[model samples]
Target: MTTISDTVALLSFLIAHPGITVAEAARATHRSPRTLVEELNGLLMCGVPPYSPSDYIGLTPLRAGDDSPIELHYASHFSRPLNFTPPEALAIKYALEHFSHGVDRETLAQISGLSAALESSLGGKAGAALRSAGRGFVLPARTERMRAMIGKLMQASEDRRVVEIEYYSSHRRRLDKRRVGVFEIIEHGAHFYVYAWCELANATRHFRLERIRSARVLDERFDRTPPERRDAGRMAPLFGGKAKERMLVRLDEHAAPDVVDDWRGVEGVKIKELPGGRAKMDMPLFNPFWALGFVMSLGEHAELLKPTSLRKELQGLLKDAIAAHA
Candidate 1:
């Protein structure tokens, strides 16, 4: 969904460069061409008349001899706290506003104190909701300096150079300096993490970027694995385990859409509409316990049509749960 800020940013871009094409806009904004077109359509909803055709593409002034609706003074109003492109910033803001309340408290807390500007703009209700949902949890404010430091760390990681950092680990309650061989930046839920080999620890560890008090790039460099190898390592499971099994299941018509959407991450998952208002799906199981929990959440709408062992296992679990409740 397009936010007011997204619409404003696009309008600002168009007003700045009057005769730019969709492809050009996409490149400038770091957004997909299709997305830029969609954002332009949304601007049309707000009474901005933009012109785009196969040959010539640009936004014309709504009426001649009028100043652009977007003002330079108001530009900062649409600017996001994070280094996200307009659409991504808007999406994250929207999610924090709407979907965060029901999520885990720790997760909500991590996002809550990320930006003071965001908190103030969200106003009382949203702020109160976040605090209420995330009781007894607090996150350190992410200031502009911290963001800048993190950007530098990211660059160092890409260059495969050592980074010296003054870091504060809340759990440890001490500030320390160390050089790190950076591996990857991981976004777990709402938090940003640097997973790297700590020189002090001589082991891989996850460090929250927000907790770094200071950072500097070191002159030393190291040869890192190629992109393909790095990607494969990232894809590997955290826990030692055998390869996941694949299974097939059937869903009732009432459950088809939910199943399809939920199983989208499972590789090779296919859903086919069946007779008598049923749908069949093939799914990959990373861990049977996790898979069973997900399938059981669907209740009676889902049925295991194949893999009799899995069906029997789920049945036994269900029986045990009922017995425990009884």
Candidate 2:
């Protein structure tokens, strides 16, 4: 459901940018126009529940195709935009700061103004909440040139342009060049990344922004099917595919108090508390290195209870390490 403020914002934006097509509006609002249009069309059936033609709001699409002009009528109720509540205002303050990090100079100044307005307008606990919230996020310190590169990538995403980049591969420990179709910039695990289709890998990949040595925007246009654009909200796997193995492990309950809590709500990870303060966990093994590191850190407190082959592999790695140290 769209919030009143969100619906109002959409209406206002459409009015300001008259004759704007669905795609253009989608890009500006950071929404899929397909979904935006559904929300817009919903406004037509809404109003005082008389359900009469006069009571219902009217919306007419003017042009053929989705390149249509929307006409709004019987909508005097929202003449004055609504004000945000204290919590909402604080939320906006945080959101503005989150986005201001990557915006250009002009937009950064505008965000600062909006932030100031929110602070002054808020009072009491709301102001405290805003102040209490800190920059809990850490973005890689980027040079001015890198910030400009981010701007170029954003433009390429909206304009469907491909980009050629010289990226430093951490795992390979080498610099490699690739052509990628820019999809979107997203933040995950305290770092910003460019989610794109890599022509070199022929797969969707997320490249950390700081790892890109250089980039050049290409003039050629690209068409991204709905499936091609990956969602940035989820933490992308480092290996770039589905988990290949499932792992079962047991923990001495007294040893790792927060371990169960840490994975409590995660999908595909389940825990069962035992009678003697022991717990068993079953989860998909996204990465063997990650799983091994965690288990090894626990020492005698943790045990791998399933997939004997994986345990054997870990033992082999441990033996190799011991031999090297010896």
User: Which model scores highest in TM-score?
Assistant: 2
Q: Could you tell me every candidate's TM-score relative to the true structure? A: 0.36, 0.66
Model 1 accuracy (lDDT, Cα): 0.61
Off by over 4 Å in 1: 1-185, 188-228, 231-244, 264-267
Give the clashing pairs for model 2.
none
lDDT of 2 by residue, 23-94 (tens): 788888898877887888878768787677878777775322376656676666765455655567556766
Model 1 residue 302 distance off true place after TM-score fit, in angstroms: 1.5
- Model 2 TM-score is 0.66
C-alpha RMSD by candidate, in order: 13.3, 5.7
Task: Show how many residue pairs clash in every candidate, following the order shown.
Answer: 0, 0
Q: Where does candidate 1 have its weakest 10-residue lDDT segment?
A: 232-241
- Model 1, position 136, has a per-residue lDDT of 30
Error of 2 at 307 (Å): 4.4
lDDT of 1 by residue, 1-326 (tens): 76665566666666676556666767788887667666664443332234223222234423322333322222333343323343444555656654343334444566666644554555455554433343233344555564565567767888889988888854356799978877876665566777777788765666777778778888899454434333322223322222456668788888887777765555456678788777888765544665577679889998876678888988999999999999
